[model samples]
Target: MTKFFLLLSAAAIAAPAHSQTSPDSDAPEVVVTATRAAQPLSEIGQAVTVIDRAEIERRQTTVLSDLLATTPGVTVTRNGTVGALTSVRIRGAEADQTLVVIDGVRVNDPSSTGGGFNFGNLLSSSVERIEVLRGPNSVPWGSQAIGGVVNIITAAPTEGVQARANAEYGYADSVFASAGVSGKSGPVSGSLTGGYLRTDGISSATSGTERDGYRQYGATGRVGVEFAPGIGLDLRGYFADSRVAIDGFPAPDYVFADTPEYSKTREAYGYAGLHANLADGRFNNRVAFTIADINRDNYDPSFGNDPSFIGRGRSERYEYQGDFRPLDQVRVVAGVEREDSRFNDGFTFADTGITSVYGQLIVKPLDVLTITGGVRNDDHDDFGSHTTFGANAALALRTGTTVRASYGEGFKAPTLYQLFSDYGNRDLDPETARNFDIGVEQAFLGNRARVGVTYFNRRTRNQIDFRDCSPSELTTPGSICANRPFGVYDNVARAEADGVEFTLALRPVDALTLTANYSYIDTENRSVGDDFGNDLARRPKQTASVNADYRFAFGLSVGGTVTVVGDSFDDVGNTTRLDGYALAGVRAELPICERFAVYGRVDNLTDTRYETIAGYGNYGRAAYGGVRLRLK
Candidate 1:
């Protein structure tokens, strides 16, 4: 699969030549939020990708997971169909290492034992653009940013009153509806959005008929005021409610028992900030206070005796951040954050809390040189305090070419469940890592053709693992009796992972675009006194993807994408290996009028059967179509 994608990418680059074109001829300018300042894609120094509203409509993507799955260096995993526990990983890092921000506010749950983002609750329609940074971003973002960052920027109000509506239906009896309104009057501007989505998911087994699935409804609103040329304040909030069904264990005939599992989630986030201009236009300052609350309730009927388990988790976070540019060549940003979290299984688990402080600095000595450094200190009540640091330097060699090198340290504090779980047996320490990366980027033909490659290495120490052991009378003052002793978490392993990635984008013609990416990883764990010391899990050896789009003269556009995933192991034993697979998708867009459009998309064009996660079923072939309206 990897070789196939490489060939495809090579073919795209070697195809028929065309005259060079100006940057303006490629596409319209897109604003990004990852840098905290709106800038065109060509000016941003980071490895960023922006998915604009037009692309979103053309692809007919209705969910955050759906959109991210198509991007390079990203993969999505879920425990079950709709509304299930879902997470995204970048490169080959753990899901928890990636940071997710919605409207400039971090939304990762502090109560989760694994520190992963909850993608199941994030809606897609309210988003105007998404900015993705594909490498360590600790210098700009704080903790849990070892892997990368994903920022979801919502739509802003228009100049005058405007309204729009959208609806869609697709395979598996799926239905969706959304509406939004935006307006500005005097010094005030605001936008309000609401939507609902439901789907009877695909069967958990090949021949199974039961359709245990999910339904969700959500609303969001944002308002802002401008007092002066460079001063403003904005506030935003969001709420959602959802219910999903769980898939039971597979039966002898690959059938799954049908059962309804209930899960309700609610999130409210808001921020008030001031943006000011000083020293003419070269100096700027921004300060903001943000608050977020997340609550979740889960009821499952397939665990333990009487087959029932009820749980609730709540988390709240407060943040104060400020960034300043004292001069045109220097930018500094720093922030302090605190998180309070509580969890209950109706009984048995204690509440936990974590707090952290961090700061960063970015300096440019010359027009072609940039340096950045930052550090974070986390003071956890249970595991004490730990500090992490990161630094990077980049140099522009010549026109359309740059090289960068970076080093960073990361740490993950022990969760309450790991330290004080009901069945836990011992204490645990934090996990830590030191990472290094070097890369080069180039854009030729007046920025119409781009290529980038990066190499990364990470060494982890004190890695956590669960251990189970039985005690004898000599050690435990008990008779030599058999017992299924539960496991406990411990920091007892060391490991290293290294990888390389390559990306290319070319627009040889005014109406055609081609993009491709590839990644290869090698990982190993070195731990003595363990049965599977050298095992590698959750890491694929190689992966690749390619995309192409062409626009016709009659206001019609067609695009196709292909992704190939390589073999990976699920556990240390290496006995459970998932086979490699390739999947393809195609999309079409037709403009009905200047302000209206219709789009259709077909995923898994070959009806391929593959699993991104072991023991979890994935969707096969599916088709969807929708209509989009613009009030601009």
Candidate 2:
């Protein structure tokens, strides 16, 4: 690693001095909300990755899991096809350690015991791009950002009236269709998008017949108006509904005659915001409000005596943010947000609420050096208050290389279900972590090729986990051990994780582009007990991926990618292990004319049946072909 850094430093110094400058006379820049300010990406002293729309379409990726799998230091597990639950891990951290944001609004539910966002029901067709920031982001974002933050930015209206429709059919008798329209008129602009997807699912061993699988429908609408020269108003709304059949675990002795179960879920989210310029346009400000509602119903006839588990949750949030450029090179940002959440479950559980306030500053002392700092305070109705802070600095040497380092602290408050659920324990405390990272980035081949490498380390204390307890110690005083309920939430563990990641992107030629990413992690969990420390579950020791895209003459383009994941543990006991696997995919696009095009994709071309989630099976080879129509 030291050698790599030295080489990068040397290259950074030489490239700028020898290269010819562009007419723009400015460095390429990307705007991000990493600091709660629209600052350039190059100035942020952290690991950040951006996925644009063109790449999304090129890969024919239809879900968050698909996109995350390609990002550096990130891993995703998919249970099956549409509507199946999906989870993500960053930098060897657990799912709950990552924070998810949609258009600047937090999507994680405070009532969920899992403490993570569920992407099973999210509609990806409306997403324009995604920004992924790795490392502790809790100081700028809130709790649950110990590992990182992922922000999904939706698309806005275009300049002229435009419309498009797409449809695809694939293996397992799956089908999908979507249509969208967007345009600008005078000072008003609007966009509307909708889609439907369905599949019959592959055969399951537990069920003699193929499972019912899933079907989903969703719609999104947005409208924005420029009320004044430097002012705007925007309103956005979205709804999604899905029906999924659940194939429960195999019966004792691994019988395969059980009928498939089923469930239904509905979700709706909406937001409205106003933006304005202040201090003669030197400061930009935004005030926004959002609401989200979710309902889920499950039906399992096999559990004859058990009552159905039904849940309904609702959340509302309000935010006010301001960005001020006090000087040419100094920017200050501050924000305050409040969230109120309520849940009604068939079982007994009380309503819960959480609120937070945050502030940040970014300063550039020299053209090549930038510094950032931020802090946040959060108050939970049940856990009182906790604070987190972060600091980072970046230096760009005269050579074409940049170096950055950062340190931060994060905390995750106990959830309502963890404290007050039917099987919950109230003695559990919040989890906390302190993390640090350092990295370097270098450009070569006339800026057409870029290489980046980073090293990250994190130490977490008072981690929450389940512990076996005797029946007599329970509040209800039942035979808990006899019932085989071996776990209860408690703070009993400390964990440490360190990892190195490398990424390379090269446009070898104008018509071809290639990219590669690799990561290696070392993780350990220390629990005061007879058991020795072990590697954390579901965190692969090594992972790598490579992709290439080529454009042929006559408006034809093709792309391919291959991914490899190393071995990992399945559970805390470390008794179960998931084997490594590799998979490949290819896609092609042909434009028949300016107004129409056709595309096709083949995934898991090798028909690899690998378990991303231990004990759970993944889908086999699948293929999809589609056509798109454009109108202007």
Candidate 3:
């Protein structure tokens, strides 16, 4: 499989060059997360993957994480079924290091142990677009961007009134449905979407017998009003409520098994902004306020009806951004932001705040060359002040070649839970990292085919990890473990990751499209411990996927995808191994008249048995069928 990927990559690079055009004309051409401003793909030096609504529907993906797994430089692991604990890692970075933004609002949970966003309950119901940046970018986004950033854009108003609805049913007693509407009238524009899903999921424990169930309800809304030519007010909001049955360690033998245990999560975020463009769109300014609130509870029927555990997290942010273009060749973007976060564990409460200011310069010294530089300073209430810098350059040649390079620094403050929880440490320092990458891409066959390769390296220090207390330390007075008996969080680990990514896209003919990408990531723990030099837990060294889709002249479409992953150890000590596996999926859509269509998909077509995490059961072969309706 590795050899096949390499050979395909070589063939693509060796292909003859032709007049340059976009390899995928239908893909989103503008990206907003790279510089906190909309920029053409050719001008951005970062490694990014853009997935639009058309691509999502083509694959018939119901879950957002399932779609993200197909992108390059990304890896996803779900503990068991659909609604279990899910984590996404980029370029071998920790799951919590990735920053998640929805409609321009940060949604990381401050009350969680790692303060990361759970992708398990995220559905593709109202998502219009998704942008994944595969390297550290702290200059514009602030903390928790050590790994990279995932920016999600939900449904928005269009030029005319439109309505869409979809419904599906499948194995495991599952049901899914969603509906959305968007329109513009005069100066006002608005959109709203609602989604629901429920399923009798597979057991979380490998040895369990009972079936676990899951359910979710979600909605997204956006409204905008233009008062003047370039002045507008924007409001956006999102909410999701979910409940999932989970397995737990039983009391008798203390072994993993099915139990009457469940978890519930409620998440909501909102954003409001006022913007104006002056000097004929040369100078733009925006003032925004954003808030995110999340609540989680765990219950055990044997222990009564009340929740056994409860957690609440909330964040409020105020920010101002300005963009100025004095000349066509130079542009400047600057922003100031203040964010406050609070967390409660039903028994204890804590709060923290951070203030930051940043500025970036984008200059086009030549028509084909673009360079960008930026710096940021953040003042945390507990961790003092820290600074970060980043730079990147992109060069495009008339010979159908483009070269890109970037260097970025990342700084992440400790989460509220890590600083105030029972096992927390107040003297912990912030985690930091340095990331670099370079790549070259070539267009061939009149840009109907393209090939690209990139190399990236990152080093992280002062990584926070839990350290168990020794017997002597527990007995010593005034020690770090004076009160805590089990363990404490401390900055004790260092790590490094280096990887290569290859991408190929081909449009051999007008009706068929094929795309493939392969990633090889090497990660190691460099901390001073017995586990030093060992590969990071659950991080496979190689992952690759190939997808093809064809649209017939008879209003019918068919697509299929195959994904392969390499083996890796499941523990930092390299004791247990989790063998890798391959998965295949097939989907077809046929239009019935002009406003309705029918779709069906078969996942795990070969019934391959695999597990991303140890001792967790994965899905088997399943089939689903759905229908879609559109009105304009």
Candidate 4:
């Protein structure tokens, strides 16, 4: 890690030293995840990545997690094929520490072991845009932002009537189809999209022979009505039902292998809100209600006809937000919210609630500078109250350069599963962290080339981890694990992560675009145990990706992508090693008419053998083709 940083410093010092001016004329991009309100990307100090619908179509990626893995400071690990257990880690933080929001509603599962959102079931077909904040910002987002935030925004109303559809088929007898429509007829505007996917996948275990399969049906919709010039009502909803074959250890062998086991999951999220613009749109206020419901079931045909396990989780939230701009240079955003969570495991039920109030102040002290500060207070039913604060600043110069710095604090309350599951420990405490980062960006060559680099550091305490029950404790009277022979959850871990991210984009010509990024993260386990000072499990220290796309004069486009990942330990003890690997793919599209087009892509061109999770199978060389139709 030290050598890597030294090389990075050397490269920075060797770069050309020259004065440049801002020449770009394109409109500035707008993002909402950083501040929970629409703000120009250049005015925010936090690191953020935006992937739009055009980019999604260009990549030809059906699974959202696959695309997210290529971004800087992000890592994804899957147990098996599509629809299997998948986890996303940001900057070496645990999966559950990252908050996921879909269409303004939190979608994390309260019944899961870690209460994290599963990215495996998320398809990119209905998504219109995604905003990823790369560091802790709990002050505005509330709890579970210890790592970062992933905000997914779906399709919205369009100006005129429009419709689009796509269908694709590929390896493993896979099939995918989707359609969407959006328009505004009178005072009402609405959009709806639906999709389906099915694939005969490979075995979950590396050495297994039997093939597993997966199927999913999903949909999203939004409707809005403008009653008057300053008042409106909006509604949104999302739904998905999926099933995937899984492998388990049979009694005879008690080893990881293929088995007649599978799991089914259903997720539904909904939101309704009323908004009013007062004082000539300077004071905007909104009141909203949201809910997330999830159900999961696992079955083992070899054992019985009924499901062997069942789990359910739900979240209901009431929120009110108001943002006022009393002066042209000053803006204040404030919000109050209450959330209730419930979980059931077919045997016992548990619930919890939290109330939070937060506010932020945005000040443009000068024409070239902007500063933001925020604070939040949350009171949990079991954990009492906690407060957090965050602040950031951005400085832009006419020389086409920008400098940013930020300090943030975050926390994550214990989930119902951790506090009430079979191995639960009611004494578990919430996780907390402190984060800091600074970065600079520069654009040159008539705004055709751009480069940026950032450095971040974070420290976390009271991290909850699974602890094995000792023989003596299991048999002792009145012990914490007196009757629990397996294990228990406890807040007995600490961690620290520091990393550097570098990004580059070049549009050397009118028809070609090239982009690349690299990240180096150094993570350590600070707990007092044998794994002390060791690297975190399943987190790569280095990751890099490069992509290039070109369009011809006759409506033909071609592109390719390459991703490289470095190796790291699979466990905290560092007893198992996972090797590094590379992936490469190519794609092309050609228009057949004004409203129709054909496209194809070949993934895993080299068929590299690799694994993100130990003992899990990974896909190989595969090919796919599709057709698209659009009408306006």
Candidate 5:
């Protein structure tokens, strides 16, 4: 109450700032990943973050994972440089527990041995915006959402004819270039983008000195047509081909040399959808179909044979959703979906299918109070049925302050490899999670400056772990043991994680902007094992970042970022240790003309050595200069 009164007094003093509010402002922009329908970020109860294309371009980051690492509640671990295997974890969840979506399609590889999305090959050249929703949100997204969701939106035509191109050169003999064209004509709008990059990257093994190279080419296209006043048809497609050098496992001594090994990856993703607005725009309906396919070929000529392994996977999904606003202050959303997944390796094939239905409601009964609730039912081909639910509330105080809380359930079904492979266990149950969060925020300077704090807790049950089993244990008819010496996946342990996240954004002057965030996570493994009572592997206890940018009157912009990552355990047994590290970077841009700009970036300013993964090597100081052209 005291804070509320203080804010009221501030509002009165700043009454002249009332003209700063707008629906198109950053704070009021519509976000869809939270509830499957567009809602202003200021009205959302869940913790969400949006990174626009302007910020992405200003950072001059080559890989998408680099942009995500600085986000609060997110941690990225890469085995090597770009094109190497990379994992992203949110809120202390495992890598596989988070889901990645591209234009409403789940893109996680079904055939991956780890059953997770590889962030190494993802590029930002064709992205318009990215939304990261933290915490359990499995109601709209079926599986692999125990942690959170990363939703990527591809670029689209905004108005008249437009074209843009970029080219850059950097360290390790790397080169990057991209071109795009977009336009709107009458009832039709479309965009096409293409990019190619190659890098002679640093070594992967900590003790190795040889370089590992990578190359990739990709294209993205989208077209949308309006059939009637409020009806539309959309089509989207993406394809990529790349080859990356591989570093084999080390010997018992945990030291090795780089070898002549590489793997080729090919991917194709497509989406088609139709949307309509009826009943004077009070009712909205949309139907979409999506497909994701991937193929991989591996070769190690140094091993005598020309090849080692080949893999294939595919997934398809069909969905329908509806949003209704029967009352002025109430809204409802409902949806149904079906998805199929398949994995193949020459002689063996595995498949799974799932069907689900979900519903959510939002109501504002009181002038200052808003409530949201949702539930979902999933029916799996092998696991029968499971139910999940979520609830949230938010209150807006008179001083432009807000308080919010939420609780949600999450579940993830076992992968095909876990259920039907040589070391599979068909009796393994789906992993379940219970998560909750509470937060408060206060606005200063008429929303120009803002501060917020959030606390979150999540507990998971029936976690799958692999352990050695004796012959007798494997011989039993009804057991959780496999015959292979590598052990089998089985429900073994439980886990709980709690964390606090803080964020601040301030525009103290018209030409300068500053932002900072910090996150602290504490994890507990409550199962009897070597890792019991220890924190999860690679989950740091503290991570913080600070960034500032300033623009001069002469069309020059300068910015820098400082990042700190605390110490963490690399192995589950808490044996291998990784020391904490801090890194700094700087960037600058100068506008040459209204439609063209020149920029330069320098990373690892102080050349601080660090390792996100225990045995992997990170690049030292690197410099890059690029040119950008835009015409509309």
Candidate 6:
């Protein structure tokens, strides 16, 4: 890690030294996730990052998590290889506190112990855009927005029939393919996509020999119809069936290998929406219904023959949203949401319901200043009601500098598994966070270069964790064992995280773009005694990334990415530490024709041996190449 940082410093000293500028006339279009409404990137007061379609295709990523791991202020922790339990944390927050949204629906699994969205099976084939809004944004987004929001937006229908296909083959006998089509006729538009992926991955445990394999088949479809100039109806559906090998306790040789334990998971989601604008486009409304279902069956071929059904979970959501511009300089957005979650194990079934109402106002009293404020109230069937608030401000000075600041309160309800599982505790309270951030950005050299620095702080309370309360301490009324009995979840953990983020973007030439970002995070576990004042798990003190790309003539391009991560602990008490490392990759694309192209990438150029988890396997030097075809 030290050598890596030294190299990074040398590169910075030798380069033009800046980053990709915030969206401007020379940049991309407006983004909708930052404000819950379409707005330019520079007009928002929050730290939001957007990875668009072009960038996605340029990278030719296999999974959604890979792309997120390269961004600033985010961390991806995996148990072992692909298809394993992968968790994404933003700025030292727990996995469950970060919300994942596909289109307009929150997709956290209620059956999971933490009620967090798993990043294992999310493919990048059908996604057109991904916007990561950092910090607590609980006003527009509801519960579980304590850390931030990852909005995966899919491809919208385009005019005329357009088709695209992709195929890739790489090391470890990995294979990937995807085909998709989209079209629009008059007022009707639709899109359909399908993909398949398989990989023979390495062992879960470092000492294991046998390989673990994974495969996934998925499809997505969407249709839209416009009844008027600014009115539309839309329907969408997505499904993925994945088979993955997993690990449990170690064997006699202390290796978690030679096990025939695997799981097959089928996840499905459906959504329907009615969106329209009325009264000369001043009032806009959207009514949507979403359904998310997950079914899993665990199997141990060593004991039986075929995979057996293990568990099933489902979530249904309904929402009504409205945006109105009462005055030229004032806008208001409000929404009402209700969600139902259920889980069944073929015996004991549990369910819960949550309802919420939220509203926000945006006022632009001065052309150079913007103000935003919002409030939200949520009622959980199991717990009582809770309220949240958020506010933001942005001011643009005439000297080509912008100042921004924001503060928000966030909360997350307990999951069904946490309330009804074997270690369930019915007295748990909702987790909460108080978040604040401030920053200033300045553009130079005809807006071709930009540099910014931001400081953020978040405090979390009422965190839940399981504990054995038997030895000379508190005990439950029920009895199962004489000496060791009580084990239940409790809200006894609190956390504090503060960080500074620096960004630089510069387009020194017409065909070359350079960007760099660095984050310094200091965290303390202010929990109820145990592990108190300790640094959080899997959160490194510093993370930095640099991206450089130059497009040449004749439809040829080359790009490279480098990331450096600092050392950090891997457990609650900081007993286990995972050494940090550096990763480097280069990519190139060659256009075969007007509608055909071949692209390849080499990852882990240094093959630096490192692990994110103590006993997990790490990916080494690997290479992959593929072709793309477009028909219109």
- Lowest summed lDDT over 10 consecutive residues: which window, candidate 3? 13-22
Clashes in candidate 2: how many?
5
**Candidate 2 worst ten-residue window by lDDT:** 16-25
**Each prediction's Cα RMSD?**
4.5, 5.8, 3.4, 4.4, 5.6, 2.6
| TM-score of every candidate | 0.87, 0.91, 0.96, 0.95, 0.94, 0.95
- Candidate 5, residues 320-382, lDDT tens digits: the string is 999999997899999999999999865568999999999999898986887889999999998
lDDT of 1 by residue, 41-148 (tens): 433444556676666665566778766765666767666566677888776667877788887777776546665678876768688778777666654455566567
User: Which residue window of length 10 is worst by lDDT in model 6?
Assistant: 15-24
Clashes of each: 0, 5, 0, 0, 0, 5
Q: Residue 378 of model 4: what lDDT?
A: 97
Error of 3 at 449 (Å): 0.5
Residue-level error in angstroms, candidate 3, position 186:
0.6
Q: How high is the CA lDDT of each candidate model?
A: 0.69, 0.76, 0.90, 0.89, 0.83, 0.83
Residue 73, candidate 4: how far off, in angstroms? 0.4
| 2 against 6, candidate with superior TM-score | 6
Candidates 1 and 3 compared: the better one by lDDT is 3
Clashes of 4: 0
What lDDT tens digits, residue by residue, belong to model 3 across residues 1-632? Answer: 75445433432332211111227575537899989998988888989888888888888888899888878889999978788888999999999999999999999998888899999989999999999998999999999999999999999999899999999999899999999999999999999999999999899888887888999999999999999999999999999999999999979888888898999999999999999999998999999999999999999999899999998999999999999999999999999999999999987799999999999999999989999999999999988899999999999887879999999998779998889888888888999999999999998888788899999999999999999998888879978787678899999999999999999888877777778889999999999989999999989999987777777799888777777888988899999999888777777899998999999988877788888889899889999999999999
Candidate that would win on TM-score: 3
Off by over 4 Å in 5: 1-27, 250-255, 304-306, 482-484
Angstrom error at residue 78, model 2: 2.1
Candidate 1 segments exceeding 4 Å error: 2-47, 205-207, 227-229, 250-262, 272-289, 300-307, 423-427, 472-484, 529-535
